[model samples]
Each structure stands twice: as C-alpha cells, then as structure tokens.
Target: MNSTTVSPVAEVGMLSARERSDHTAFVDGGFLYVWGGHHSVAGEEVFFPSDEIWVYDMSSGVWTIYAMGGEIPPTLSQTCGCCVNGVLYIFGGCAENGHTNQLYCVDLLDGMFTWRNVTDSTGTPPSPRDKHSCWVYADRLIYFGGYGCKQMREVTDSRRFITDEMSWVTIGTMLFRFWGWNNEVHVFDPRTNTWSEPQMHGIPPKPRAAHSSATLGRMGYVCGGVEAPSMNIHCLDLETWTWTEIVPTSTVPVERSWHTLTPLSDSTLFLFGGLSMSGETLSDGWIFDVHRKEWRELQHSHRDKPRLWHSACLGQDSDVIVFGGSRDYALLADTISVLQSPSQSHCSDLLLFDTQPLPLLRLCEDCIGRNARTLEQQLSWLPKKIQEKLRKRILFFRTAKSQGTYNSR
Candidate 1:
C-alpha cells in the first residue's frame, strides 16, 4: 500500500506538568483530577483503605486529600474504572479482605459518592472479577472479561450500565476469554447500551495484562503489555472491527506494564513510564503515529523519577497530567510531573534519508501509453542513492515508532 510521509514539526509550546504521589491510581476529569490508593508511612506493603481519596489537579499540580466519609466500600486493587460526563465509575476489584462485586461512582463535579449492589439487580452481572477492562461510550459503561477466583481464567461474559436508567444489564459475550490479558479492546454503543463482540481481522495476538489501550477518533490502539515471551503492540479499527499488528522500525522503548496511553490531536499516541519486568520503574516517553503506523522515541531532559501503576490523562490545551505509582518497590506520594511537547525552537533539524533500492518503477498502463518515453525522463534526475535512503528511513521510522521502545532492534 502507498503511504504518506509526514515531516517532523518543530516543537513550539509546552503544557503544564504536575507531581502527585500515591500508588496505583487512575486519572479522570479529562486529565485534571487523579485519584489513587493510599499507602502506609513505614514504607511497607499495606492494603489500600477506601476511606480516603487522593485527588490531584494538573492546572496547579497539587494533591488534595478527600475524606470519603459514610459507608465507603472496602479498599481494592486491579479495579476497572471509566469516566462518563464528570463522574467516575469503579467496578470489580479485589478488596483487602476479599474479592468484591460491587459498583461505585464518584462525582467529580459535585464531590459525592454512591455505591450499588450489583447482585440486587435483575440483569446478571459478570462473575465477581478483578483486573478486568472497562470503558465508557455515550451514557453507558461497558465491562469485559476479568480474572475470577482462579486468577486469569478469562471471563467471557460482558455487562454494561445505562446512566439514564441507573440499571445494569448483560451484553453479548466476547468470542474469546480475555482473562489472561488486560490489553483486550472492548468497544461499546451508548445508544443501545450494548457491546459488540470483540472483532478484528487476521490472527489475533495472545492475551496479555497490564498493557495500555486508548481511543483515537474511531480507532483504538493497544501497546506494550506482557504475555509469556515479550511485549507486543496492536491496533483495532472500530469502524471495521479489524486488527493490525504494529512492527516498530526504530530503537523501541523498554517493555513495560501499567503505563498510560493518551491520544493527541495530530493522530499520534503518547506513552509514558511504567514498570519493567525486572521490577524497576521508568520515566521515558514515546509517541506512535496512528495514520502511518510508526513510532518515535522522545528525548526528555527534565524527566521525572521512574514509576509504575500510575495514572495519566490529557489536560487542558496540550498538557498531560500524571499521578501516583511506586518507586523502588515502595509506594510513593511526592513525585509528579507535568509534561508538554517541547518548544519548536528546542527541536533540532532532522535530516531523514532513505537507503534502499527503489522497486521497479511502475506507472498506470494508460498514463504510460500516453507518454511512454517521458516516464524515464522524469526519473532521470532522481538519484538512486538518495531515493533508496529516503525509503529506508521512512520504513525504519514507521516500524520503530509503532511498536514502541521495547521490541526495536
């Protein structure tokens, strides 16, 4: 297929960055507010408590502690979350004491909380699950398979809740059980409040967990999650329900999990730090071009300390807000960074060259027939070396940028 090339634009501006420390939290409010789990002061592993909610704002880069008084649900982990309007919905997480099948919603605009017992409803909710995947479409929240008691058994059933009716209902089941991996893509229709069965073209990759997925326009991209052997990246076209594997052409980023993926306006996806397999945290960033299926490793001079299980979201203007994770195996509460694309003046000129022989040049038979000899004349001034270099660069960059930093050679 013919592909279009995009020149790297100069970095012209920066967005605000913030540092709020907590562990294994999620970001909401369009990247403005980050809510995270609490940790003990002794720097030891402690179960998160549901009584307090840590909140961080990107504009001021400040962390605010909120007391969730009343009958708060128990603290939990591997919980799936989604934001609809200004409210945050959390579902199906393993609590400190045991697994939980409850559903809770936190209002960002009003600062109120509501918990519902899913068992009391008529529609059958998916089995008690943890580490599941969920997303919001229109007014409905769609949930997919998660680990049951066996842990990573792949729950195939699906369920959703319509905000207008304040009710829960079961959607169709996914064709494949996704319990083993968290990177599976689940799309929902808000108008009907139902999930379309997982659809994609070609043989799908194996299931994985701790990967990152996000929507860009009508397409969804999944990147950098671990399976048995290594991390892999994939994309799904929502319109056609098709899947394509992305092979990077540059030095890819390190393999990681629990990272954040945010969509930018320029048809690119931005990825931030996460935990490497060796349990070390990372602070590097990368970008993937969705249209061209390419990847680009970013150079950050003012990068923050490495972290894992943190939350990130796009903020006002071009800003990105990140919050909460662990460092050195200890839960953290003090390091936060607001990252923005560097100013265009800071970007150095990049001379891209291709380094491959051109394919046998071909023209439309009718066009060649109209001016058969002229085609050769048009190609005379094009240097084969330069042409080859440009082709190689384009192919290399596209492959490297799409797969992220880990798989690049």
Candidate 2:
C-alpha cells in the first residue's frame, strides 16, 4: 500500500467553502449524506439546524441540501451514526440542553425522506453519551465505548470505569464526578426493534471516548482514545462476542483522536488526519493491512491541510472523501487556547484521495461516456451486459454534466 502519492484532495469549483467539524457522513448509492455536527466561524461556534442534511453526489460532484421531513433529534455534535442498507440510524450525542439518548432513523431512497424517533424500542437503551462510534454488520448496529452518564440500577458490569478515573480532571467537577466513560457494548436490531448486550469474555481495552472505528467482515476494529499517546488497536469478533488487542508488527501511526478510518477493502483501511496526543492537529495519512497487521504511510500532496474532528467515508469509485473540519482549534469554545496553533481552524473543503491512479482507463471511459449516444448504433455488436454497463456510465456522466458540477479535480 506504500506509494508516492500523486493527486491531492479533489477540489470542487462550484461548491462554496464552509468550515464544519464534528459532522457525520455516509455513502449510499453513489452519493454521500452528511449531517449533524457543528462548525466555528468568526471566532464563534456555529450549529446547523438538526433537521437539515447535505447530500453530495459523487458521480455528479454536486452538493445539495435536503430539509428532512418527520421527527428530528435535537442533538448536534458527537452523535454515533451509521448507514445500513438504505436506512440511517443515530443514537445519543451532546445537544443544546445537554447529553441525550435519542434514536433517530431515516430512509434515504424511500420516496418520503423523513426521520423517525425510535428511542422507545423494545429493549433498554444506553445512557446519554457522545463521541461513540457505531458499526453496522449483518443488519445490526454495534456500539462501543464513549463518554456518558453512569447508570444507577445496573452497576453490575462496568463498575470499574468511573468518572473519577480521569486524573486530569480540573474543571466541571460535577460532570467529572457524576458523568464518566464506559467500555460497554450494545447491539440494536432494527428487524424486531430490540436492544441486546451480549456476554463478552476476553479482556477488553480501557474505557475510552472520541476513538475511531471501522467494520471489516465479522470483525470491528477500534483504535486510540485511551487518554494517552499510544497507537493501541482492539478487534472485536462479532461471531464470538470477544475482544483481542492487536500489536502492529511494524511502525505505527502517531497517537491521535478525532481522525477517520475508512475501509478500502475487506482487509484494508485508510486512516487520516486527527488531533495528536500532544493536542496538535495532524495531517499524516496511513494505510493499514489487516491480514499482515502492518501500517504503511502515504506520501501525498496537501499535507499542509491539517484537520481534526472531520468526517471521511469510502466513495463509490473506491476513493476516500473527506469533508468539513477545523484547520485550527482557535475558534473552539471549550478547547484551551494554549493547545492550538494559530491558523484557519474552520474549513469547508471537500477532498478526494485516489490511492490508485488509472489515468488511461479514466480517459477512455470519459471519451466513451461523452459520445455514448452517438455510438448507440454500434452497441448491437456487443453483449447485453456490457451494453448495459456502458449505458449506466453514460447516464452518470450526463447527470454530472447537467448538474454543472463536472470538473476534473
């Protein structure tokens, strides 16, 4: 996976720049759906209306906002979300009032684009929390460690992780003593609308929040967020409900949080910019080979663009799509001024990273797409499946042209 990076993040001409951070994005049918989170501008933290969603057509390279219909949750930042099939499900986050345990779902392709509050499902829900990561496998949502309130009734399982576990607690005394972190795992099944916590056996990692995660087959990988400068990775086996730590055989990434992890294949994942353990924002990129258990760095352009708390997802073309995050932490209200370097923290730039170059193939495809209609008479000599494939690409290319967002970025 190590190669001299060529093209940097793909830039869009028609898309206006708007700095955003702590947002969430997912891919569905060649389009990227972004929502939630907040951004700071002009030294002030800005929050978007929770009901509005930004849709980016990867095929067309166009951006559109959809004001969703039906119930919308009030929370903004640090919410756990994931898209399974055509449905998007969200659970818990910090809102204007405070932390909440609200479950919201929406169907992106259904004629009715609406969100439904499903918090009152059949089983018990987790406590109000933020900064957790969710993984979807076998049509179920798997949730793990994050910051949240402690439950009184069932101190039976996660009693070891308490709010006072943090030695650096100096502010928010009440929050430090009452609210804390947990390493609990919860499963939500949409088929029957029930929540279940499987009995786990193996030794689990330390309770953490603000970590990154990715789903590969039956295994879910979690990294960092141990409140220390360490590159620790833990893997969860979905079939057995077990956890095992992974020790990379080679060089590891710098300890970071608030970064992104996108799976390139069943055994490959791309890790990007994050806040370092020293409180500095990072711009290095790494590719992890799961089978070999090794980390390889990507020498790419645009390393000058450092971002944290940003959102990234795998695109339809097997490219990595990164969007909306702070370039600096100066505009943050909660972050200490000494921790951040002076720079433009709020960024609205959307970048595409192509790991593998196919310039010749792409050129040919473009030529064919542009003149697909003219060559329709020649399709009689080709197989039906190949003809259908050509037609689909032509339709996609034309859609992008019609949207006026077709650019060679």
Candidate 3:
C-alpha cells in the first residue's frame, strides 16, 4: 500500500491530453499502468488508436508518460492486459488493418523496463481476436471468448425459436442464435510455453464476446458482456475445471456491455459503466459480494457520466480508478475519477486520528474502551451491524480534537 495520506473525500481529476477510450489498465507495484486505447478529436467521427503508455502514481497522484523501449507495439484498441509477477502482458486487440494474434510484454522488474515479444513455438496459439477476456491464475493465463475465426459458436442462422415458452431447447442450443460468440477455453502456461485446451466439465457459459474474467481463490468468475447483458454470472473452478452459474440475490444489472467487473479486497466485484443494448450509455455502478451472492448499487453520488469502452483499475486503499471511455456522440472523456470506498474513508479517519496530540488522545481514550490495542481489535468489540459506523465516527472526531492546534496558526 502507498504510505502517503489520501483523503477520504473522493476526487475527480482530468488528465491533459490523456483522453481515450477502449483502453486496458492494470495495477503493478502500487502504480497503475494504462496502454493502447483510442481517442477521437472534436468534430471527427474516427477514433485514432494509441500506442503510448501512461503510468499513474498511487502515492503522489501523478501521471507519467513513457516512451517505451524496444519494438513499439502497433496502435490498437480493445486489447486485454494482466500483470504476472512484475511483467505486464498485453495480448491481442483490434489493429489498424484488423485484429491481431501478437503477444507483447513490458518488463518492470529489475528496473530494466523493456518490451519483449514472446515467441510461442511450443503449441498453436489462440486465434487472432479482440474483445476477449484474459486472466492470470497461478502461473497460467486463461483466455476466453472474442471476435475471431474460430467455429465455436453453437448456432447458425437456420435455428429459430417460435416462442419464449419453448422449454425443450437446451441453453447451449438456444444461445447459438447470437453469432460471434465463443465457448472455447484456452489456457497458456508461461513456465513451459505451452497451450492447452482444457476439456471443461459441467455446463459452460453461453458464448459471448467482451465479457470480464477475474480470479477468486481457485475459481475464475465471469460476468455480463455483449450479446447477453442480463447480468448472468458464471464461475469456473480451476481445480475441477467445472462451471457453476452464480445468481445474484438482488435486481440484476441491466443488459449491457463494455463495463468493468473489478475485484476488490473486500470480496466484492465493483461493476462500473457500460453501454446497454439500446445504445444508451450507462453511468450506474454496483458492488457484488461474491460470497454472499448479493448486489448493491452505490448510492453516494459523484460525477455520473454515461460511459462505455472505458477501463477501470482497482488502486491502493480501496480506490477504484476509472479512466478513458466514450460517451454519447463518440465524445472521448479525458477525465480520471476515483470511486472511494467506505473502508478507504474510514482508513483516512484512522490516519488523521493517529497523529493527534497526547492530551487529545487521552481524552478519547475512555470512549475507545480498553484492550483496544489496534483499530482491528477495537472494531472486534463492536457488533457486526454498527462496527464500521462507530469506527468511522470515533476516528473522525479524534482528528477534530487536534484541529484547534493548527487553526491557531
């Protein structure tokens, strides 16, 4: 975690000349790295793909633009990226002429930052495609559905359903109506440079493109994407190679695509903006507790811009940083916003309280109770329902007690 004190109050800042959309970002070494998105000029209908790399400092709140060494990757959009160890792996995306199958990486370890185009001579690589999903589990990289040449789709134009009441059709058979979807599962082991198409068990997710995948424990969870935006969630057990459908206990997210399903430290996936099937950009955000199988919409109001094709990266101290995406009329936003969690706000309160004067600390000692050696220990005494509330309120006022010392200056 970054040691610098970050305020609990949420902040939104616009980056100059950093406006883009359809980009990919990941956190490595407490810093956020962004790469390969497209930006549109005012009064222009076309989006120019970017090959530049942008780094955001979590502690100092600064952005660094780096001219990467080695063979620079082609300008692309809708790519997938994940951090393995200290290396950032960038996979296939839509290029200028078309989609690509190239895999590139930038080494951040040993302070020798350089790009390397890894050769895949061991086995056949997956088809060249974009709008797919990739996740790093242990030492393997799992790749899933995308717009590609593979004949993984279930149905053709010949299949038709007369009514919604047709219960005889299996899900795999019925989902074939939506073309350009892939149910194939591909795994790449970086250690041996091998690719394996695992014969997965149980019912696989309906083929769809542009979905999000993340690792939780030994399971890989996938959620909502284009062609099927009904908030259907599925998890693949990495151990058993089986798929289990997870139904949320709340109202499902609207049918949408291009949104982010980011895993947070609190065992919840923070879902952000995307585009609905009606071509309407959505600004709503929700948090889904994977363990409890519940969804709760974030009610604290901030800047609400309906966006699609944006990238979201979870930052230090429970801050979900959102950057670059398209709004209505293809207007590209250059803004960066941090969605602050309550735990983060509480964290700030704890920071402020810890720096108070001795007399002030003594005054609040009684209210804090005994044997409360640490914040966690103190919080342990409170009931589950109101523990967080009491923790925040107590910590906030502890700093308020020391305000007069600075105010006098």
Per-model RMSD to reference: 17.7, 7.4, 12.5
Put down candidate 2 lDDT per residue, 63-146, tens digits, no spaces.
Answer: 666667789778567888898888888889888777788889988766455789995788878878888888888999999888
TM values, all candidates: 0.59, 0.81, 0.69
Ranking by lDDT: 2, 3, 1
Model 1 residue 173 CA deviation in Å: 29
Instruction: Evaluate model 3: give its TM-score.
Output: 0.69
Please list all clashing residue pairs in model 2, or write none if there are none. 10-352, 18-348, 19-347, 327-345, 328-345
> What is the per-residue lDDT of model 3 for residues 224-316, given as tens digits with 9 covering 90 to 100?
775456686788988778989888888887877777877775467878777676656777888788888888887533324555676777654
Per-residue C-alpha lDDT of model 1 across residues 1-409, encoded as one tens digit per residue: 0001211122111211122233334455422343445443343334455555545332222334444544466767667776777666667776756556676665555544434333333343444555555544346565543443322244332222111111111112432322223333454443343434554466454554456767666555666654421344566666665767777765677787667777666487778877676656677777777666567776654254555556666654444445445443422221011121121011111111111122333123223333434554554366997444334334333333342211110
Computed on alpha carbons, the lDDT of every model, listed in order, comes to 0.47, 0.73, 0.59
Q: In terms of TM-score, which candidate is strongest?
A: 2
Pick by TM-score: 1 or 3, better one: 3
Best by lDDT: 2
